[model samples]
Structures are given as C-alpha cells and as structure tokens.
Target: EPEVTQTPSHQVTQMGQEVILRCVPISNHLYFYWYRQILGQKVEFLVSFYNNEISEKSEIFDDQFSVERPDGSNFTLKIRSTKLEDSAMYFCASSAGGVHEQFFGPGTRLTVL
Candidate 1:
C-alpha cells in the first residue's frame, strides 16, 4: 500500500540551527497539510497548500518557517532558526480532494534544546 513517508523520525538539535522536515505525500493526492503537536497538547494546524500556493496558514506559521514542494513527490518544511518551543512532532498529511479525509504519516519528532 502507498503511504506518506518522513525521514529521521526523531531529530535532535540545538536552539539556533536550522532543520528541514521532509515528507512524500501519496502520489495521487492533491491537497497537503502540515500539523504539529507539542507533548501532551492538541494537534494544531500549521499550513495547508494546494496548486503550489498556500491555501491557509495558522498564526503559528511565522517568519521563520516555510514549506515547499521541491518536486512532484517531495514536500518539505524548513525552519530557518530553531527555538526551544519549536520542539514538537511534525506530521505531514494529504487528501484526495477538498473536504476529503486526510491521511497522515507516522510523524517527525523535532527536539530543540
């Protein structure tokens, strides 16, 4: 079965460095999203993208963050400078159509010290 994949399930880094979390969403899906969950906290939407432009972004998506579809299959989230509060599990998801169910990957756990 086809599934979304993320690299380095756990990433540990210092507070000032950059980090790029990668994902490859399902091949036929059209909509993509990124969400983060702090430990013991509710999952929060970060951004959603379609047709190569951002559809929606939450207040948490600040200047330090960016998303890209560098290729047909690869999606990435880059954090220019990490802060301690940036520590969280980043999940990549995709849906076949608007208002459809989103399928999620296992997630990338980013830990900034």
Candidate 2:
C-alpha cells in the first residue's frame, strides 16, 4: 500500500540554524498536513495545505515556519531558525478527502541543541 515517506530519519542541528524537512505523501491524497509531537506530548497540528495554498494554520505555526509543494510528489516544511523547543518528531500526513482516514509518514526526528 502507498504511504508517506520522510527523508533523513534523524536530524541534529544547532538552535539557530534553518532546517528543511521533506516528505512525499500518497499520490492520490488531496489534502496534506504537517504535525509535530514534542517528546512526550500529544500530536499538534502545524499547518494544512491544499490546491497549492495554505488552507489553515495553527498558532504554533509562526512566521518562522513555512510549507510548500515544490512539485506534484513532494511536500516540505521549513523552519527559518530552529529553537530548542522545536526539537520533536515531525510527521507528514495526507487524506483523500473529508472524513477519510489520514495516512501518516514514519516521521522525521529533529533534534535542536
């Protein structure tokens, strides 16, 4: 079955450096989203994208964070400057449409020091 795939399973970076996390979601899904889970916290939504535009974003997704689909098959999240709090497991997910089950990627573990 098709599933989302993220690159660089683990990333270690300095507190102020920029980082770009990449993901490739299922081909037929129409909605894409980025989410993060701090160490022991529950998953938090960051942003949602559709039709090449941001459909909605959470307060957690501040000016420093951005998402884009450079092409048909890839989705990406960029953090202009990393903060210690930004260290978490970032996941990429997609759903076919409303009420459909979302498929999530294994996740990219980002570590900031």
Candidate 3:
C-alpha cells in the first residue's frame, strides 16, 4: 500500500532560524497540501499544490513560508525565519483528486525557542 512519509518527526530550533520539513507522498497521488496545528489548537491549512503550482494558500502562508516539490516524489515546506509562535505540528497530505479523501503523513513537530 502507498502512504505519505515524512522526515525528522520532530525538530527543535531557535527563533530566527530556518527549518525545512519534508514529505513523500504516494506515487499515484496528485494534490499535495501542507497544514499546521498549534498545540491545543485546530488544524490550519497552509497551502495546497497541484500540477507543480500552488492551487490555494491561506493567510498564514506569508513571505517567510514557501512550499516546493523539489523532485517528482518529494514535497517540502520551508520556513525562512522561525518564530516562537511557529512551534506546532506540521502535516503533509496528498489526494488523488478532489473527489477522494486526503491521506496525511505522521507530521513533523517543530519546536521553536
């Protein structure tokens, strides 16, 4: 069975530093998305990518945040400057299409101090 895989399940960084979270989705999946959930908070959508372009993005995806599909298989989210508030669990998801349910990775827990 195909599944989404993420690297560095947890990360610890300092404020003003940068962090990159990586994910590899099922090969057959098309749509890709990044979402975040602050501790004790609801899940928030960050961005969605399809056909190698950004299909949708939320207000939380500011200039400091960027998403890239570096290769055909990997999707990544980069935060240029980490802030204390950036501490959260970031999830990577993929789906075959709008009609299908999105499959999510285990998530990367980022901690900023």
> Superposing all C-alpha atoms, what RMSD in Å does each candidate have to the true structure?
0.7, 0.8, 0.8
Candidate 3 has an lDDT of: 0.95
TM-score of each candidate? 0.97, 0.97, 0.97
lDDT of 2 by residue, 1-113 (tens): 89899997999999999999999999999899999999999999999998899999999999999999999999999999999999999999998877457889999999999
Please give the lDDT score for candidate 1.
0.95
User: Which residue pairs clash in candidate 2?
Assistant: none
Model 1 lDDT, residue 96, Cα: 89
For candidate 3, write residues 4-106 as lDDT tens digits: 9998899999999999999998899999999999999999999999999999999999999999999999999999999999999999999997655899999
Which candidate would rank higher by lDDT, 2 or 3?
A: 3
Tell me the spans in candidate 2 whose CA falls farther than 4 Å from its real position. Answer: none
lDDT score of residue 54 within candidate 3: 96
**CA lDDT of each candidate?**
0.95, 0.95, 0.95
For the record, the alpha-carbon RMSD of candidate 1 to the native fold, in angstroms, is: 0.7
TM-score of 1: 0.97
Per-residue lDDT tens digits of candidate 1, residues 1-113?
88999887999999999999999999999999999999999999999999998999999999999999999999999999999999999999998876769999999999999
